[model samples]
Target: MLASRFGAAAVAIMCAASAPAFADDTLKKLGQFQSTGAPGEIPQVEQGGKKAENLRAIAPKIKVPDGFKVELYAIVPDARHMAVGTNVGVVFVGTRKTKAWAVTDRDGDDVADEVKEFAPSIKKSNPNGMCFTPDGFLYMAEHNRVLLFPAAEFFYESPDVAVEVIAEQLIPKAEESFNHGARACVVGPDDKLYIPLGQPFNVPPKDKLPLYDEQGMSGIIRMDRDGKNREVFALGVRNSVGLAFNPKNGELWFTDNQVDGMGDDIPPGELNRATKAGQNFGFPWYGGGMVRTKEYQGEQPPADAVKPEIEFAAHAADLGMRFYTGEQFPEKYRGGIFVAEHGSWNRKKPVGARIMFVTLKADGSADKAEVFADGWLDDKTGRYLGRPVDVAVALDGSLLVSDDLSGAIWRISYKD
Candidate 1:
């Protein structure tokens, strides 16, 4: 029944729409059948309605520093990375699931007035990365392709907005893995589109090292807006899901989820900085800086393998991050980094499920890291109420955090 509906709906929509004929193949492949149903038909792991009501009941329990308050901004299923629309004040959210959402607040109220799917006509697989170029173009990086929606903020509600494939065949269709396939993208200060391609293994298999290194897998790559001049910008990273360019120095910063199965506390997750192009951050050779993995224990690390700027708690699962350039917060938060730790699944005692702040010194080096907001994980019950996946600063200077577990976006604001 699910496949029938999916296939019929897809065929009908394709026939009614003006999209290219090749989109049929893409939609068919994305609809690969499973025992449960079509992959796209799988209900979002987190949902709205009853789940959202429960989440709202716990919203007041969330903890933040003094003078700060947390409120439910919107209910968006499977919200991952977020990009705020420049002209329309719409917050665009990407997801590992089929749909991407655009959230809006038409009135002056901080809460959202409407949350709707963006570009329902387009078929996307693991469209987890979303960003807006400085010139206002919105780009979405999916598992195997990248898309550009020109003037997306203006025409998101329309069913016939133009969609261009900027890049495709990013990872070979045959080599696609169920794990670490969701990507993250950012428009860097250089005006290039930067994307991180995670190698598919806890520690990449030795047999695949050459192919991974040559193709910039397990690292970050950049290309022009037209998808030309593709080149490896950084290498030797392990499943980095977050990328942010500092507004002050334009350097790249990211969160690297370290290898698992090494006990709860052996290797730590990392928050790293890359000051220049072609630099490598140690991965298989040294898992999360200095903790050698058994797979590559005897191997030698690259001479220039850079270390992380700060080491987070092991199994924290640090994912999305951003540099705070907003003025709504206190003066002390200016130029600091806000990271979303999505929490842990395998640990005996789960950690993270909160936001962290990392302050930078005058010299542009990290000074300290501390929790900015928490209480998502109840200490008494050891269960998580929400898992934060991404952070974004709204145009009004408020901080927005996307929680995938609870299917909600939270607004963190400050008042004197």
Candidate 2:
């Protein structure tokens, strides 16, 4: 397919031609993605009854393409759409409501035991972005800063303390209307931290019909590992609560929440690929590649504005994303991306609440999208059995999902 698109010889030539620019652009996007502290992971969780915290039984019933099986990998308490990490073989996850971090060791044998907490509490702050670096140090992203603790101290409290503040004092003041407190961060290819500082509110235009640009308070920011070198990569983005580096192209991808109160199906949510730094993605000016309605008149972006890779249904509230790199799934999905739809609240009718896949083409556009897992939200009564927040690859080549609504972790694997 790639050869057909770019030609057999053109692949090499084009790669050579684009390599330098791609690398430079990739570095900029990486810094932009991690400018905050650490980006969070979303787990697509079931919304039914208050189920028991068991990783084994929760794995099944997840719908997937052929040749795939789902199972419970680990059970976590109050698991939000935050990040997770593994070292040697231990798996760790961060949470928000409980202000705690948990870990489980799932070796290649498909068994996860020794469930425990890595960090106790952060006191009045949300716990997100618990991940590892190319080095061995484990990192966690709180609301306004990133904290690092020794890996050995994960099992037991260690007297050897090495806590460093990578990023601090973010967005001292924001628009009074926005509800964006979910800032996620990750390390970029340049070894610097990229963090997302979200916008302030769900705004409307000045007068009413034909939406206009409502700028300020919402954008993707970049910073160094030590919290220096801060800059805005793109503006007008409402909020990218989750971010992930595309394993195939090394580009940064994010899920943006469309502004609400625009009806259930207008101005759908978006899955955006950050191809260049300082690229403006249509936010208040436009949504889902179409102009939206607003209360006040505003300036619209030029026709040259970058469009989204994929536009989800209105109010889907797409969040965390993970590129599938496991061996358990079929070959077709080996290099695809999985996104978690946390569902929406302000809409008259709720949408999302499932795990979906973005099938990428050689040109990097999403050719099509389909649900990898469903049964989360009910269409008949508008009730939800589960709410998916983030997706992650487990040690055994299975997929793990976190549910903030139910505070549970689910595992989906293949067995054929």
Candidate 3:
């Protein structure tokens, strides 16, 4: 009996070894569908739940400014960066997961009426960067490629809307890491598309520096709408998950996640401003700003490394930010910035998981950073109910915050 069992097990192992290796299912499904077929019904589309009970339970816990009120806008799963559509009451959201989502408010109400999968035909891997041009084109930056959807607002409901590839193999496919794979993109005032390419390592090895520098890794790169005139805009950006162009002067501002494993309060996260191209924000050289990392402690850094304009708390994991240009808020809020701190994962005591407000001076520099909203993380238990990832200003001038942890988009509006 023992001999017979052994023989059977050997046969099973041999059969398993002979089986063909499976290809990625998502890649096979790419470009398979292109038509919506029917209104309000798309296959594999998941709608955002109302979740009234869950909203009521957490609504009171969220603390905003005195005159502002927070309400549940929509329940978007794995929501990350957002792009507000022009002339269409639609909000396009990117995700670190498989799909992108579109949240719409059809009846002129502040609340979102529908949330559905965007371009179900496309197989997206970490499509976490989205931006809209003034001309009504929507561009999405995925892990391995960039795509442009022409007239996205008008043709979003139709699956057959035109799709164009801006670029492929934006980053080296072999160097892809799950830790910092999500890319952030924005359309700059210069009519160029800017995308950040984060280095795969916590502190890149000495041997990899030359290759990284040559490939524009750990830096921001800009190119024309057709992917021409590509050049490195900024360097030494460890992992910037958010990028925004200031409406006043067209300067670029972004949030960088500092290195991990350091003591809690030594190296702070960064809010950096790049006034011109070819600037380098200190990274592995100076983890956040001043504190140096052990990996490159003895090495010399670029002499012209620019410092951060504002420093956030250590391990804050600042992700997405947008300058407040809307008129719905108080006068003080105009020209200010709203940042979503996604919270820290490696900290012994968790920090962040809130919305931060940065007041800017007339010259476009930040004066101070303050907490705009809180209560997502429980101070007593070190537990977070939601992790805010991105902030977008709606057409009505309300602020929309996307929380990937809670799978919800929240709206903060002011009342007189």
Candidate 4:
């Protein structure tokens, strides 16, 4: 029934409106299908007051799979990408402002009873991402630097301690703008910190710098835990908001957001798999294998530069990739890749704003994209409830997707 209505309605809209309108409606219809329940609300948790349980959505309602349930994990007010500690049983998330938080399930009920502010009044240059290492130390990505605090301090009893700068003065400054900031970081299989530095203002570079420059260093960079041995791990990437190392195959995967100013539907965004240390996925010169604008006189990728493993629609704004290693879902979904699309602002029509699952082949490659959660972006009315920014697997093997638009977190788990 839904398909029949969508087919007819889409054809008429496609015929009447421009390609942007047609693409928006079609993608929304594809992303709108989910077994929805009552709305999930954000709970207000103060320092001492009783943590509120029932909070309402500041944006649109979230959607999830069948037999799967969703609840508001934490209403962080401006939450970003999340990091989980396997040993600590604690979830750490950051905000763009001067604060980062640790959400913990103390009583083991699988719900966060306590949400503590770890670093307060932080410098809000660009607090983008955080992650933990196999040895159990916590790391936070400060723009051009990293602040490391003891995980034991957050879990055990400790006063608010100043974060120690394990890495400093690493990222080179951009001349015009630093919008990309330090996007995300993760400890790879080699036990090294893999951090992303984006292009400066999306402008093409005229000449390479003797030291580190923004254009050349815009890709993923790798460093030791002590911030030593800094080198470009990958190149030709404009901005990758989220990245993860696959547990099954030990390969690094990333979601790269393309440049703006091209027509709405020119080049699709990319889900790139980093096969080697120095692989260069096309950016600036070519996006999704489509030639982009000639502005800034960007150079196209060399014929040797690799293409994306999976291509999403233009301006989908894909972020945060996580491999689902949970038992709640069917066997086929055990190790699939889950991505959060933050939705598009420059496009005439909206895309993303939801959590999507892509089935993986035995070779650790993507099959086709599927909607694991929806309703963050409205389908019928063409509005958005919230924009999903990041996704992670919780302690209980459930999925947690962060809504930056509404300052909320939605937890998903499957049941019989």
lDDT for each residue of candidate 4 in 143-200, tens digit (9 for 90 to 100)? 6668654332233222223234667665555432456664688989887888877766
Model 3 ranges off by over 4 Å: 1-40, 43-50
Per-model TM-score versus the true fold: 0.88, 0.78, 0.89, 0.81
For each candidate in the order shown, give its overall lDDT on alpha carbons.
0.83, 0.61, 0.83, 0.68
Residue 110 of model 4 has an lDDT of 62
Better of 2 and 3 by lDDT: 3
RMSD of each: 7.4, 11.3, 12.5, 17.1
Ranking by lDDT: 1, 3, 4, 2
Clash numbers, per candidate: 0, 44, 2, 5
Ranking by TM-score: 3, 1, 4, 2
- In angstroms, the error of model 2 at 98 is 5.2
Candidate 4, lDDT over the whole model? 0.68
Q: List model 3 lDDT by residue over 1-416, tens digit each.
A: 00111222332332333222211221122234234333445443333334655754786788998999988888888899999987776999999998898888888778777887887766789999999877566899998789876546765665444466778878777888877889889989888899999989889988988878777889999998778788888899999999899898889999999999989886899999999998999877998878999998998988999999999999999999999979999999998999999999888889999999999987789899999999899999998989999999999899999999988899999999
User: Top model by lDDT, which number?
Assistant: 1
* Total residue pair clashes for candidate 2: 44
Superposed model 4: Cα runs more than 4 Å off: 1-44, 47-60, 121-124, 152-157, 174-178, 208-216, 296-300
Global local distance difference test of model 2: 0.61
TM-score for candidate 2: 0.78
Q: Write one digit per residue (lDDT tens) for candidate 1, span 145-255.
A: 998765567656554445567798786676698599889999898888999999889998889888888778889999987688899899989999999999989999999
